[model samples]
Target: MAFEEAKIRFKGSISPVITPFEEDESIDFKLFKRLIDWHIESGSHGISVTGTSGEPSSLTIEERELVMETAMKTVDGRVPFLPGTGSVNHRETLRLTKAAQEMGADGAMVIVPYYNKPNQQALYNHFKTVAKSVDIPIILYNIPGRTAVNLEVDTIARLAEDCPNIIGIKESNKDFEHVNRVLLKCGRDFNLYSGIELLCYPMLAIGGAGHISATANVAPRQVAEIYNAWAEGDVTRAQHMHFAMMPLNDVLFRDTNPAPVKAALGMMGKIKPVLRKPMELPSKEIQQEIRETLMQYALVL
Candidate 1:
């Protein structure tokens, strides 16, 4: 299928879903399926997984594929499912992206090559190759904080011009000017999304498609409402939701991601507070802080 012919339009609060794990450090498909349903039920606009929040590094390739298959089955086209299919290795990124395309994903979110810190020209070549390999829309994931390299606006604009399937980006970058420049260079129709929680509304204000915020993992409806409200022409409500989410956005990142997020979910009885080795839960002080933050929204659990 050509990118134009594909029916799904990636937008709104596409949750970078956390992979639920059993207490024994196994993938918890049952809980995973339920979590997908919960995000849908909670009015998240789309579902995405195997991204940073999903702990993609911890899972084997086979485990990632199984999770993707289960997500496809469970989502059942109710909302778009975009899977993170990128890796540091070029071949691995290609293989996983092809796998996602085969699994009926609405699109693939490919991160910039990390660790190796490829040059802009190399980044362009790598993404163009990946885009050519799959017909699905390829949204570039530019998270310099974790990746240790920035996907410069010029490079991204070049890819947008060169690869039709290479669409917009999910920027976790803190530089507001850089993001603004992306929209200016890539044109407003480019499907830019904010991966940073605090910038979700600000991004929308400047023509962002939507967000894939980690905050959505704990507060889906409120998070989605920021976009929905803005789309509905209620700037006041959208601004309100944005500020409402600020404390949550702050608390969830008191520690590393998914730890506080998964811990928050666990406290709400959504999933086990289990993480694979080397990724521990939030400290007791942080957990208590997370608990108090959730209470502000009346999430007493």
Candidate 2:
């Protein structure tokens, strides 16, 4: 399918799923596949792999390939698999982008360059180069908090205007103003997803497409329900769900993300909470707190 079509079709509650690790801290293929199946079965509209939540930086190329391959195989064309193919440079991003396209991913989530911040032109060129290099659709990821270089509204507009494959974005900064700016500036075809779940209703209020959420990794139903409810015009139900999830959302991200998410998943028997090197697991106190949050939500038995 065309990038724009894919973006328009699956524009809601896609999870940047956590990569499951074994006790040895290796990728657990079995658990990973199960998670993918579970997400699909649980009603999440789409899925993203190798994102920040997926611990992309810590994964080896081979490991990255493994996760991508497993996700593609498990999803088996059931839903859109928008894997994060971002890297610090164009070549690396191209390599991963090409791999994802070849593996039957519906599209690639290309993040802004990190560590080596690039100018606006460079940023434009970086994404342009990748879009030109790949046939699959490109979903721009603007999580400036992690990358330290925001893909500004103008830059995003430029890319979306210039690059056909650059169709959508995952906006994580939770800045509703910026989100609205993108929605206002970009054409109706442009799909702007809220990477921050807290901004889902606000984003939807501003004509934003949907959300790429971390909470969905644990509460897929609740997360997806918020979108469905809102779309169905049940704003009250949607708002209630979002407010109900806020406390867990705050604690799930109390530390570096995915850590708390993985920790929460561990409590739920989803996976081991062992993050890769340089990414520590959440503290016991924090874990207990997450567990309490889960219990309160009745996500735990």
Cα lDDT computed for each candidate against the true fold: 0.91, 0.86
> Which segments of candidate 1 are over 4 A away from where they belong?
1-8
Clash pairs (backbone) in predicted model 2? none
> Candidate 1: global Cα-lDDT?
0.91
Number of clashes in every candidate structure?
A: 0, 0
224 Cα displacement, candidate 1 (Å): 0.6
Return the lDDT, model 1, position 219.
87
Q: What does candidate 2's lDDT look like per residue over 18-96, in tens digits?
A: 8988888888988988898888889899988999899988998778888898888888888888999998867778899
Please give the range of 10 consecutive residues that has the lowest summed lDDT in model 2: 2-11
Candidate 1 lDDT tens digits, 1-301: 5565432367788988999999899999999999999999999998989999999889998898899889989999998888999889899899999999887888899998889999899998999999999888989999999999999999999999998987779999999999999999998888889999999999999999899999888988899999999999999999999998899899999998989999999999999989997999988999999999999987654
**TM-scores of all candidate predictions against the true structure:** 0.97, 0.97
* Regions of candidate 2 where Cα sits further than 4 Å from its true position: none
